[model samples]
Structure formats: C-alpha cells, structure tokens
Target: MALNLNDLQIFVQAVDSGGFAAAARRLGMPKSTISKRVAALEADLETRLLHRTSRSFMLTDPGRDFYEHALAALIEAEAAESAVRQRHAEPSGIVRITASVPAAQFFLSDHLPSLAVAYPKLTLQLHATDRFVDLVQEGFDIAVRNHFAPLPDSELLQRQVSIDEVILVAAPSYLEKHGFPADPRDLKNHAGLLVSQTAKAWRLHHVDQGTISVSPHCRFIADETLVLLRAAASGLGIACLPETGCKAAMEHGQIVRVLPGWTAGTVATSILTTHRRGQLPGVRAVVEFLAKGFQAERAATGNVLEPLRETTEARS
Candidate 1:
C-alpha cells in the first residue's frame, strides 16, 4: 500500500508542535482525530514511531529517522504547491513573518496597513518575539531583525534594509535630577538601563575624536528594548536604544536624547527569507514593501546623530 501524505503531514505536525493537542490547535482539528490518524499511520507502517506518555511523548529511534525524511518530503510538497500558485498573476496567500518585538512594535506594525492596501488578497501572520526563530522549522516566510553583529552563517537569503542609529536617552525629570553629562566619560556617573542582548560597552564614534567606549554602571538590565525604554522614561536609568524605537518617546517629551552629539553605534536591519520561499509573490511583495519603507524612513529622519556636535559644543 502507498504511504498517505495526509497521515504523514499530521505526524510531522504532531512532532514539530511537541504534542498532539498542539498540532490539533495549529491545524484547527480535533485532538482525538489527530491522534487517531497518527495511530493509523503507525499501523500502516507496521512500526511504532512514538513513545507515548500521559504528560508528554518522545520519538523512538525509527521515528527520528522517519521524521527526518518526512519533513523533507513535506517541504518538497509545499514547494510544489507554491510553485503552482506562483504561476497565477495576483499575489494571494498567507505569508508568515517573524520579527523582534521592538521592530514589530515601532517599525513593522505601523507599515502593515499599507501592505494590506497594496495587496488586498494577501494574508499576513506576524510572530513578534526576541528569540531567533528557525525560519524553516517554524514555517515562517520572512524574518526582520536588527543586529549590531554580522548575521550568523546560514543558507537563508538576507537583504540589508537600513543602518539604524543607536542613541542614549533618559527622561526629562531624570536628566534634571542627575544633570546632563558634559562628556561621554561622565555617563559612568549616572544610572544605566541596559539592553542585555547588546554589547556591554557602549561604543560611540565621532568623526574627529574617533571612537570612545564607555561601560555604564547598569541599575537595570532587560532583554527587551521596550522595557529599557520604559525604564528610562520612568527615570530608572539612561538607556541605549535604536532611534526608531525612541523617536515617539522623544517627540512626546517622555524621553530625551542624553548624549546628543555622540551615538552608541549603528545596527543593521535586514529582512531574511529562504531562497525557495522568496520566489513566492506574497513573500516577495512584503520584502519589497519593507525594504522601501525603511529607506523612506531613513531619508525622512536624516542622520539623528549628526546634530549632536553643535548641541554638545554649546553646552561645553
């Protein structure tokens, strides 16, 4: 008897999701139905694939080997379907995107409405998180990320969107109490709210003075950029954040740039997608939209760190 693709797909989903219930929820099917189908698949194969338990399950040796091949097969099947769909002129399908929380909140979300208007038939599923998700494993179509270091080596295709300037900021009341630093070295005397994922030392560059690295004494540390922004706004400590993330706060007077003339550093923003998946219309449209949007934003904002020298020299 021929192997059933439907049953194989269900088995893969169950394993990938970590349990039958999760697979059911993801697939929008009943848990019992999923379990039955997988069980039927095992029966047809005449081999036990999973070691079941009340609370969890584990794959048997044979199951692991089978899973490897099954996953590849499923990917091929999807590629085949996508290839056929791409032949159509209009872009219409679900495009799953993953991005860091700050990027999603400050940058991507604001531009999504425009994407919807441009591609009416396209559906978008956004996963906002700081964790680096596996694009192939998670079945995501594209990922948007901001990083100071080179992206880890991968087969995924990456397009550089923009170089976002990082700036130091604090609330008005905090600045009033602690007094503004006269120089980059003075930042050590003030409280610091640090983004834990970034480099411990803040490296600021001046065209004439070259680069100076300062390691601020952190009063608080968090993985999320938004949390660091909020901490800075509440006067907990000064924080280093992307200009885009703090633009609204600066505009609203909730936070002010601490070292106006000096910048921490620039982080690269890139959009990543698998080579095969990038060929799909829906995925291609989103990538183009985001790349253009970032360019427009950079043009409008100018170089936020450029005017700092005048302001700093005036204070001197």
Candidate 2:
C-alpha cells in the first residue's frame, strides 16, 4: 500500500515533536487525527513506526531509517511551500511574541492592536510575563524585554529598541508628609517601594556629575513594577521606576520626580530572537518601529541613553 503524503507528514511531525499529542499541538490539528494519521502511515508501510513506552517514544530500526528519509522529504516540501508563499503571500502568518508587563502596557498594548489594523492578514499572539520566557521552548517569534544588559545567552539575537529610564519618583503628598530630603542620602529614612527582583542596589547618575550608588532600607518590597508604580503614586513610598511605566502618571501630576539630578540604573529594552539577520518581515517591522518609537519619545522624558554595554558584555 502506498502511503498518503499528508499521513506521512503527520508521522514526521509526530517523530520530530516526540509524540502524537505534541505533533497535534504544533500542527494545530486534533490529537485523535494525528494518532489516526500515524496509525495509517504505519499500516501503509506494513511496519510499526514507534515502540511505545510509559513516557517515551522509541523508533524501530526501519522506523528510524524511514524517519530520516521522511524528514528530508518534509523539509523539501516545506521549502517548496515557503517558496510558493513568498511569491504570493502578504505578511500573513502567526507571530508569537513575549514581553514584560511594563513593556507590554507602556510599549506594545497600543502598538500591537494598531499593527493588526495595519496588517489585517497578520495574526499576532502575545505572551506577557515578568519572568523570563524561553523563546525556543515557548515557541516565541520575538521577546520584548527590559535589558539592563544583553540576553542571558548568545543564542538569542537582540536589538535595543527602547531606553527606559529608572528614576526615583514619589507622590507629591508623600514628600510633604515625610518631608523631602535635600539629597539622595536621606532616601534611607523614607518608605521605599523597592522592586525586589530587578533593582537590588540603585545606581544614580547626575546629568553633569556622575553615578551614585544608593541602597534604601525598604519598608516594603513590590514583586511587580505596577505595584511599585501604584504605591508610589498613592504616596505610600518612593520608587525607582522606568520612565515609560510612570510617564502617564508623571505627566498627569499623580507622581512627581523625587531626585532630579540622580539617575538609577536605566535599562535598555531589547527585542530578542534567534534569527541573526532578522529575516522575518513581521519581526523586522516591529523591531524597526520600536527602535524609532522609543528614541523619539526620549525628549518628552529626559531618558537619555546610557549604554549598559559593560553589563551586557560581562554577561556574555
């Protein structure tokens, strides 16, 4: 019996992805359909393709040989399809992305919906989290992150799209109650809403002068930046926040800048990917847009670029 091409394709996905269920997920097909297709492939070939175990799939010798052959054929088939698509397709494909909460709200939320409007054919899937996202395993096309430095690994190709200033800000009322310290040194006495994860020690930089390292004796630790921003705005305490996260409140007079001259460690937000040259049209478009988008907004807030190059290099 001759094997159907589609069945063979399903078999390849099953083998590559390690199971029928995983293949179904990757192919966006039903698990039952994937299982049935693989079974049909086995019957057509007159041999059992996989030796099943409790938690793993093992290929028989013939199955292994067939897998190699079928995988090559699948690659050729994909290339052919891609070539045809390249000629006729618009920028229409699933673009899976990941981003931090602050970056997502401040940077992407408005832009992404607008992007969908511009490219009606394109489908965008966004995954937002404060914790690290593994691009390969999570199947993410792009990751927007707060980059005080380079990506943890060199495998990810990253571009500096936005510069988010880490600044000391507090509610005007809070300052009134606690009394504004004449300098950065007095911050130790105030109720500091410290970001427990990202900022451990504060690096404050003066425009004309230099960097001053300050570590506040915090009364409370905010697990997330939003919590930190809200608390600071509500006059609970002072916080070191990225300018984008606080820009809206800052502009509306909800929160006021605490230390005008002192700058905390400003992080450079980056778009990360595995593609070295950034070949994907969607990825390229977003990256270019972010690069220009954030840079232009710098004038409104004095978020000047301070290259965390030393940090990135050290990590790499």
Candidate 3:
C-alpha cells in the first residue's frame, strides 16, 4: 500500500502539538483538516491511531510506536536536506586535478600554498603528466592544458587562463662560444636543446610583427622541460621554453634570452572541466584560484627579461 507522507506528517505534528486544534494552529491549517488527515493515515494503515472524544485526546499503543519511527525518519530527512545545502555553500572535499609536468611544477604548484590557506577544507590530488587525460573516464575534476594552436573541439568546457610566450634561452657561456643569432635564419647554425629530435622547426614572431620559421640543429633532446632547462643552463644549446618557466633562471643570470626581439611562439594555457558552470564548490574554488594566479604570474614574469635584455644590448 502507498503510504500518504502528508498524512504521516500531520499525524506526527498532531501528537506533538497535543491535539488536532493545536497542530492546525502550528501548521496554519483548520482543525477539521488536521483531524481528517490523521484519520486518513489510520485508515491507510488499517489501525486505530488515536482515541478522539469531546474533552480528551489520546494515542493507541500502535499509534505511539508509529509516532516514534515517523518522527525519527522526519528528522533524518531534514538533516539530509541541510547537508546537501551546505555543500553548495562551502568548499569541502577532494578535487582531483591533472596537468603537464611543467605546468604542475612552474604554474600550478606556486598557487597551492595559498589555496590551502584560503580553503582549509579542500584537498587537492594532482596528477602531473604530459599525456592527455580523459576527464570523465579518468574521474578527474580539472585539467590544465597548454595548446600551441587553437584548441580542438571537445566535450570538456575550456577556459583560457593565460598566454605563455615561448622564447629561446641559453647559458651565457654557450652564447659567447657559439655567438648570438643576428637574424632569425642565423638560428639554423646554432645547436638546439630540443624536446623532440624529429627535425622540429621553430616559428618565431618578431617585435616588428614579422615571422620566420627555422629548423635548429638538435644537440640534446628531452621531452621534459626541466631537462631542457638544465641542458641550456649547462651551456649545451639554445632551448625554447615558456617565459614563465625561464623567469627565475633569467633573473639569476643562469641563462639569458637568445635573439631578444623574437619569440618561438605563444601558447594558450587553459582549464578544462566537465561542466561550464555550477560545478562543485571545491572544484569551482580551485578553477577560479588557478585562473587568477596564472594571470598574475604572467604579468609578473613579463619584465624578468629587462635586466638580461639591457646586458645583451650592451654586448652587441
């Protein structure tokens, strides 16, 4: 038999309020409606739940038993509702995130300390890899991707975080020994610390809005950014790296910019997710935090080359 939940609620309220009249006052309904609902509930259960008379109102033994269980169920239901509402208000849970090694190291890692302080209840699990991750299949909450070209269409919602400029850098000693490139084509003669050995071409964009593509001679090859950074700093060859990754080394004079007026390219860094909006509070908090942090990082790193630029100009 299908139990009438409304009648069940009225029956419990009538017991607690001491009478049908008082329950009607509390529930803002007429006493006759309150009495009828409890009667309907008794009929549905095929049990006499109340002894009603002109002066006295009382409960049957079965009515007392049912009242206890019904009241407990009602309380549990209310608590569940409150808990769900709290999730929307607070960011508290594990948010699994994925990104490339360099992105996780240089960009994403920088924001974690502050993110922890801001959202104490949020826990982050980072998966750092260069391979593409299927967010849905892999059960990831967020993914930061670096795109060298326009991002391909996908089921994931993509939000552009920042544009990272790719530039050529090498140790000062390497540049001194091999000599700096005076023009874009001159890069062909220079040894390159490349991510891949497959005769890669570096497409350079100049300050004067000019563009050129040159295939550098690969001297050292590594798919990892940190490896390439170390090779360049050790005076192995000129390495093309994101400006954000090169910022500290340039400031420390470990490496200097090559062909100062040109850049290899600009990469778009984006945040990918399963939903465009209305994400879990923890996930939304993380996304917004990273987006703001990357923008600030890009702005701060923009001038890291100024000192190097001046030093290089003096030598030329």
Please report how far candidate 1 places residue 132 from its true position, in Å.
2.4
Compose the digit string of candidate 3's lDDT tens values, residues 1-316. 8776677789899998889999999999999999888877888789998888988889899988999988888888788888688666878889888898888888878887789889999898999988878888888988887777876676667777777789899999999999988887998899988888674888889879699889888799998888899999999999999888999899999999988879987776778877633267788888888887887786686632311110111100
| lDDT of the structure predicted as candidate 1 | 0.84
Per-residue lDDT over 1-316 for candidate 2, one digit per residue giving the tens place of the 0 to 100 score? 6556787788888888998789999999999899887777778779998996668888999999998988888788889888676645556677888888877878788688877887787788988897877777778878888767645656667666566668889999998999887787787777878867556567778878786777776766877788888888888888888877888898899999888767786777777776632557666565656666666566566655653221222111
* Predicted structure with the largest TM-score when compared to the true one: 3
For each candidate in turn, the TM-score is 0.66, 0.64, 0.69
Q: What TM-score would candidate 1 get against the native?
A: 0.66
Q: How far is 122's C-alpha from truth in model 1 (Å)? A: 1.0
Task: Give the C-alpha miss distance for residue 230 in model 1, angstroms.
Answer: 1.2
**Model 2 TM-score on a 0 to 1 scale:** 0.64
Off by over 4 Å in 3: 1-88, 207-209, 276-278, 303-316
Show where candidate 1 strays beyond 4 Å. Answer: 1-88, 197-200, 304-316
Local accuracy by lDDT, each model: 0.84, 0.76, 0.82
How many clashes would you count in candidate 1? 2
